[model samples]
Target chain A: MTTGAKRPKRQTAKRTPPKAPPPWDPSIVVFACNWCSYAGADTAGVSRIQHQPHFRMIRVMCSGRIQPGFVLRAFEKGADGVLVSGCHFGDCHYIFGNERAVEQFEKTKEVVKLLGLEEGRLRLEWISAAEGVRFAQVINEFTDQVRTLGPSPWNGKRQQSVGRAAGQRPTTES
Target chain B: MPELAEAAKKTKAWACYDCGKCTATCPIARVGGSYSPRRHVLATNLGQQREIVENNTLFTCLTCSLCDRRCPAQVTYTELVRDLRELSHGHGVEPECPHGGALQSVMRMMAKGGTQQNRMGWLSQDLKTESAKGQVFYWTGCTMYYDAFFPEFQVKTLEGTRSAVRLMNKLGINPVVSPDERCCGHDLLWNGDRKSFELLAEHNVKLVANSGAELLVTSCAECLRTWKVDYEPFFGAKPPRIVHVTEYLAEHLPDLKFDTDRAAGTGPDGDGSRGPVRVTYQDPCRLGRHLGIYFAPRQLLEALPGVELSEMRRSEAAAICCAGGTWSNCDRFAKQIQVERLREARATGAQVLVTACPKCQVHFRCAMKDPNLGGEIEIEMRDVVELVDQAVGQK
Candidate 1:
């Protein structure tokens, strides 16, 4: 049975006081809606399933609330990875809410690259409240992907990295 | 490949297990208590064609992404719903919405310039067949051009779109425009006018081919959805590069200097004294759900500096439809769904409701006036372009 405690440090090194790691362990923020994805996480807890400890979740009423700018803001605030979880199509507590997330994911993928982030760093998934195992699997997979991508360019080298290469603006690469 | 598109293309109707989650969650599904996606999909798969098409449930769909966002199989339920509506229309089944008069009026206005076609008129002044002399053409859909109720919005749309064109021009790319541009079969396709849709598609595709313009840019979400998704298959040729105006604008906003003041939340009195307003945004189904255009509008809104953009309880993929989606044309049913949408928007505590689609703006505005919705909320609706227009001194 999984305990509700934070996972033991794995491949993470503590840095000097007052400063984040130079090659920081990636931070991920997941915005999960209450109806499906959030409940899925809740089910994971109830089921005693274990997942990665790389993410901090914020519960939203629906996946439709996830704006691409919020993902960009998370990235700007040093989030190396972001996950948006919603109900599968036709399962939203609000009709069409998950579909909006599906559409937004397309543009968000482009925007992430436009900001120079790696592909798959940000993900949109449809995880029902009953799918505890799926939720655990998605979190673990996303955590590993972010680990490979490393810290976002915006987070490291605060002084020298001002703009442009810092992934602030849209680029032709998207 | 986006999963929504892939799923929509692949999934068969019987895949749905009839969880009733989609109907229960739908903003419009509760209207008259007669709408249900699970039932509709089940019926369609069972070949209960006559019954499914005749039912008012199909029209109750706001075409919102809520069901799409929640489906476990990613069944693309909404597309199936749209197909049902088309079938119903094919059988000469008429929805209860007053869409007929509105669409006819809107189409007539598009043929002749009027207040409705303000944005298109603005385009006529700045762009022309001569300007769009290259191998590109702009499909000025009816919503952007002939929607008179949204004058301020139309102007802002032109300004932002023009800014993008200017940037492209500076980049040594001169995309052409045709003053003779007509609707891209968005309304016809959505409303089940398949024959008209085909004619317009053929006509527009031929026009673009003859003009030698390989690119097409439009500010309308519906146009982008139809042109890219529906028409491309029919043409059997590489479709033009159809882009939403916001996508084009975000690419160039940093280079353009514009002064915009934030209008967060204000009371019914339009007073700023109510402490910084807690503002939220609603994603139009086409722009947010169909096209994945959640960021561009948010970037435009967030760029205003002090505006605290709190998200709606249901946003992006999970957003409730404004109830004015293409299928909402069936009168009493559409209004019923609109009422539900108003309640959801009111729940956001956002004094000002912002969206990109003119249809959403109109529905939200009308819904706010319903006496049944508990005496009104001091909410104002505006397009994203209107806000940008105010910022750039074009207002």
Candidate 2:
């Protein structure tokens, strides 16, 4: 049987191996407010709550500090999804920081949508510091949602091809 | 430093003979800022690269090209500022962009490519647009972004773009409006981000080329100048002929039908019922001084029945800038320039301050928000296309 299998090696060489695309995992960026959502993420960690491990947390002083630029920069740098988590309304440490975050998030949402990203890819949620299980739930939910949407158009292969296409174009003048 | 000398030689900054005309003509200098085109030229000529970069006047220039008009030696002052800015940007010196650089970040993100944009959300059911191939391609620029970013301004930048398309539709032409059309990179190039600008330009050039369009029409003055002047040299063979929307519409003046009666009675302040609706033209520096599109907009405005075109004191080549350009250095100086320009517009005795540039509309409206000004400079602002669309009776 081993000799028979070896006899087909010449036939195998004539056929190309099937190219299996690498299994894709969502790359999510979570912008957490230091006073609330960041602490919530910490609590989830300390509680050993099992959440999706795909997200990277960036702690900002206040939710208001997350400008549209911050979220845009994340997408520009090829983030699959971005979650801007903040303190609940009226529960903000600085009185109205979360309110301002709502305003900024609306603007960011418009830009993100206009840029043709999936509506679910960008989200704003109010997570309290004590809500460890809730943080884990949000994380797992967001990661699963992003996974269903597949890799962002800005991700690896598409980006490389775009660069290659631009490079291939004729440059008639300097 | 050698790049600075090269820039100087290329722009003919060496031809400057210490003449104060450029300084006198500079809007920033007029507003009492230390920004002088002549001073920068002298510094570049003397090879004082460090002084020029550290002084940071390079970003302060509005690059309106007004100084180019005043220069007897024909020195291209605006190009010098642009090249110097490109150098400064390479050295990691970033401009103090307004709105905390949110707008700039949006533009930079677009430059990255491969981000599919839903730019056609503004295209309504009535407006006919072809996506794949057409003779005319309408480049929307960043109107949708601006509309979302500055909702408080109530300028409705996208509305002007929509009006442009509607006008084209009325002329029995279905323009190709690409959803993948990116920013013209006018702001990025002027802000000294050459690499990002090139990326956007390449994407746009390829998009238009693939669309098989022979004529590319844009409503934005900055985008028009960018496509016509900056992007032309870098484009591959057989680039489409770029024209401003007003310029294109002006050519087909005979074909356009306007409802003069409706336009006369539809003034915001109810003053149009008395006589022809008086509108003063605010020459966007890009359209006027840069592209020399002085008559096209005026020609279109005059063609609209019941719409009287009032020229401001500083109209045409002498027009003041919208104060803000390239989204950089929008400081008290910019506000002052805006306030003064608004006051001039108010003095023209025209109820409507009509401008062809969306930035001019945005800047002037922003200046009007000054609580202290208190209705003194509160003239109604409208884009030329919006008025034309109204006069044509949007079906």
Candidate 3:
């Protein structure tokens, strides 16, 4: 064949460039309702339950106060996963606080998933104040799942670099 | 091409179930069942660029989200309609503006950076309004101007703003209100005029920001929705807390002086003291479905003495959109919907039809006065804030 014309004859010797694995250590953010989920998280720590230690938790008075903006803010701040937990459905300390959370979760989940953030990355659960073991289990499971998903596209750490143009200094947010 | 792609993803116009559930439940289609939303989606998929932009159906949509809500495929038909309007605008195939384009022109003029607007001409000296220095800013959005535009309808929409101010003043809270405040760009955005929407949004945001107001209170439901939902996301900054007057007032109602003695004559006993006036509320779509604020307006009415708060059959999430919502979509369908809605309100034995938005007041009043109806639907349309004002004092 003429030089630079057509040269795809060999099929045996394939030189595969090594694929670099994603950062497996996930940074998670959790918004725990003060009346139940926050207490549940505290119980988990006090009981010495084994769970992932990579979450920054913010305690809101009620799950009803956890707006979609708060969840998206966490993701933007480099969170690989966000867990929004409140009281059991009917056991909300403030009557129907968890009901409000459930209502907002439906809309928020759709938007979160649409942003290419896998549905699992943004989770909503009803964890009671006494469910310390369940809370720990959820954390461990969520951490592992997020680890498989790798770094979040919205992660502040990565976006600063990804969005940077050639020669522009990286943002100092991360 | 980029706009088309983004619009596609936003609307899920590509997601085709071909089930026609959207068309089945669409209010517009129910009126005729011709020009179905499914056809629009099919047209979109076929890349029928010319027909999509130039067709009358593009401007006929109420943008009410009924189709979007009922779509089994979860396709956002409302957003699709909006994006189509944008494409139509790009292709220069705009609909005939309802009022010789006067209203649209006023809104567009407000967007050109700094245009001095005497929006506060409705403010009376008797009402205690703080300068642009209070912690709470009252957003009297286009109420005075709406009064000027629809003078024939005799809808004193500015009365809502006055009532809100009076109620706030009675509560010992002085709210900042400005004459410089322009349109909230609610119509412009939905009409596919994003450039004008952005200009108005940025201008209003900066104006409110400079006022040093911690919270922005609006009696207008559309204004509250636009400011809270659209402007906040676009600004990328912590927008000042935006609240509907009903919500803001209801939140602080615990300390309100509900002096029941003055409501004597309005009572059912041919006296306002204790008997309740039979009233039905028109849930402004922006207030009810868009912001999920169905209860606040009702709560105020229910709490007021000599007020019987009745529910319209299609209230709350299923509330019908106001007839004069999108200026681009003005048609016989819009007027017919308003007339029918008025009949529903009148059927409830509601002497007074209470609504939270000025546009609702204007449209309902216009329909009520139509000779075609022959004055059969005789119902007084009043803003809930006006009732609140009367409850507080005689003036």
Q: Among these predicted structures, which one has the highest TM-score?
A: 2
List TM-score per model, in order. Answer: 0.57, 0.89, 0.66
Predictions' DockQ, in order: 0.01, 0.43, 0.01
Between candidates 1 and 2, which one is better according to DockQ?
2
Q: What tens-digit string does per-residue lDDT give for candidate 2 at B1-395?
A: 68978988999999999978999988888888877888889999999988878887788888889999999999999999999999889888888877778788778878876668888889999999998799999988888888887777777788899999999999999999988888889999999999999999888899899999999999999999999999976778899999999999999988888886777766734454666788899999999989899999999998887788888888899999998988997888889999999889888899899888888888888889999979999988888888888888844
- lDDT to native, each model: 0.63, 0.86, 0.76
Supply fnat for every model shown: 0.00, 0.61, 0.00
Q: How would the candidate models be sorted by lDDT, starting from the highest?
A: 2, 3, 1
Candidate topping DockQ: 2
lDDT of 1 by residue, B163-198 (tens): 445444443456665645656767656665566677
**iRMSD, all candidates:** 18.2, 1.6, 18.5
Residue B278 in candidate 2, Cα distance off native in Å: 1.7
Once superposed on the true structure, which residue ranges of model 1 sit more than 4 Å away at CA?
A: A1-174, B1-11, B99-131, B135-137, B144-146, B149-175, B235-238, B260-279, B327-333, B343-351, B371-375
Per-residue lDDT of B99 in model 1: 29
Of the candidates numbered 1 and 3, which has the greater TM-score value? 3
Error of 3 at B219 (Å): 1.2
